[model samples]
Target: MELLELPLDEHLEAVEKAIGEWTEQQKRRCKSAQRTSSVEVAKSEEELRELQKQKLELLEAIKQAEVAREQQKRRIAANENETRDLQAEIMKAEPIITSLKSRENLHQGNLGNLNQESNKSAQAHAQVVDELMKGISLYQKLGLLIDKKRENNLAFIFTQLDPNNPNREFSFSLRIEDNPDVFLVENCVPEVSDVNELLDQLNKTGNISTFVRAMRLRFKNLV
Candidate 1:
């Protein structure tokens, strides 16, 4: 029962058995540490894959935004070009519009002048008619039976007759031509007459009585 009494071989065996147990415990601890290191490596690799995927998505979004920006720029440029062309067309039409307005004003002015000239010609013709009626009244006052027999293009025909005998008659005519200055006498039986000679004498003498005396002498039978 005492230590000294125990055998030496038994003591040696006991020491060897304890050493083997310690070695086995250290091997198990080594295996557990290796498993934990492998799990950590797997987790790190999964995190890296997630980060790479997020970066790729960001790159794709950036590319899409750039393409939209380029499209907007093109649309703006096209609109600007269309506006410029429309302005150019408007500028080209302005002169033609002005020219047409000027022509219309000119035509209106010419029409106004023509209307004034027409009114003046009408007034002059009315004056000539009034003077001719006065001359007819004077002939009637001279005791001559003057009858308006007929009318033609250039003259009015009148027959001067002796009141006692209708057959003893002379034909007198008053004529007007386009020229207002010219005076005419036609069909004088006793002598060919130029009334212009009397008008010239009247202009020189400035005497209405002399002019009347000349007219009476020229138409002595009717006077």
Candidate 2:
């Protein structure tokens, strides 16, 4: 049993079998490593695809946000323009409003003055009417007095007596010319035979009372 160990051929065959088993084990290991590497590459490719999709979605969102911002800016600008226009219109109207207020005040003052003047004129007209009434009353009284003094056949006329006709029995007239306070007194006597002589005497005397006295002396019963 201890003969130099097995024969030389038996030793060589054993060594060859061990070497073949080791080589087959190494080949299986290399194939497993290659499969693992392929799976990792596939996972990495899937992650890259997801990243690309997310980037596209983010780009779209950003674009929409930019468009909305532009629209908002335009609206703000339009509002600012409208506000400026309103302010300009108000500035233009300010002076006209002030002038209208001033004119209204002036018109009110003029109306007040006109009312006061109208009241004064009405009062003055009433006073003038009262004076005219008083004058008419006095004229009637004088007419009645002259009527009482006249004789039965010789009548004394006060109104509308003709100064040119000396044939009338007795005529007296009061006439007011341009002046309301001053009057002219005219009298005619028919008893005086000569009308021209009586006119001459009246002109010379220039006094109505003297002419009346002379007429009374000439005719005792004449009025």
Candidate 3:
């Protein structure tokens, strides 16, 4: 599947600048071509004909640009909605899985320990995993890069942690060619906390000194 993610405002600005320059060049070229084709426009009919053609070309260019802009807005909106929905799904699953874990510890052995709690925890975990995978797949479809630090969030983690450590290695790294927004943990256990929030802050915080100060507060492990 293709990797698709939302472009931040800066990226959209760059796109607008590039498009504006291209459109200006196109307008100039069209006017130049018309100059080369100019004839005796002393006649009102001929002048009107030329004006009509130039106006039509400009109108076409405006329409094309508008269509492209609207499409980008739609794509960005859809991606944001997808993230919110997936986050909500994970939030809903959190309590159920935590409850199952506590229940399992309370009833671990008997002549017939049903293991129902364990099964539910396993199932709840699976549901979270599945939802995350879907989120990742949707990211792949968006076709934008969300990372400035590295590739996806998964790669950012791997680069920080040692792969040889049993507890550090992910089952596999979640990678999408140009996007960093859809990293998901799999098979292997992850450091339990809010990794997504960490990534979001990293992207949002552009300056290094500010980020360090924020990290000290958020992780609480920093000296």
Candidate 4:
């Protein structure tokens, strides 16, 4: 009986040892699986954080786009108001501008008429001057010389008194005045006492050539 009991005890011990080794192996496999699960969880958490950051940035961009769109709408409204005001002002000014243009056209027509009258007067004056110059040329050969000055307002008369002394001259100046229209004699080389009487006759008759001839005859008698 003792020998049979000893063999049974040895078999039991072997079974117990086998059971302990299997339990240790199962514990090691469980710990390894837990470690792998922790690594997967950490990777998933990091990915989730990155996705949340990207979502916040996208939301901020959308908000900024909305603000810019509102500002653009306000600017467009302001430009439209300014455009309408300018158009209204232009409409108000149209009649005044038309009246000013009409007045300008009327003034231009009056100026044209005045210019035509002025040209006709100048032509008539030129013809009169041409005839006077021709008469003066004829008188010059008869020992009478006339010099006009001060826009024809002053006249210088030179007369040869003595036929033998052709170089001897009796010279006098006559100035014309507009108020009452009188001829004033000035700077007579040989003073004549009857010059005022002769000037009165010339002014009354408005005959300058006849007075010059008579004055030359008087100077010749004195010589």
Which tens-of-lDDT digit does each residue in 1-223 have in candidate 3? 1233345566778999999999999999989877755643345667788999999999999999999999999999999999999999999999999999888777665413546654554565455445544444433332212222332323212212343442342222333222232324332234435545654554464232333233334423311
Residue 54 lDDT (model 1): 85
- Clashes per prediction? 0, 0, 12, 0
Across residues 67-100, which tens digit of lDDT does each residue of candidate 1 receive? 9889989988988998898889889988988898
Worst 10 residues of 4 by lDDT: 150-159
Write the number of the candidate with greater lDDT, choosing between 1 and 3.
1
lDDT of 2 by residue, 1-223 (tens): 6466666567877888777887788778878877887888888899889999999999999999999999999999999999899999989999999999999999999999978876665564444334433434453443312332321111234332234533333454433222222223445544345534654665565443444344444443343
- Highest TM-score against the true fold, candidate: 4
Pairs clashing in candidate 4?
Answer: none
Residue 44's lDDT within candidate 2 is 86
| Overall lDDT per candidate, in order of appearance | 0.59, 0.56, 0.51, 0.75
Tell me the TM-score of model 2: 0.35
Q: How do the residues 1-223 of candidate 4 rate in per-residue lDDT, one tens digit apiece?
A: 9999998999899888888898888888888888988898998899899999999999999999999999999999999999999999999999999999999999999999978876765564454345556656776776666666654344545555577887788877766554445667788778888998999997787666677677777777778
Task: TM-score each candidate.
Answer: 0.33, 0.35, 0.24, 0.53
Poorest 10 consecutive residues by lDDT, candidate 1: 149-158
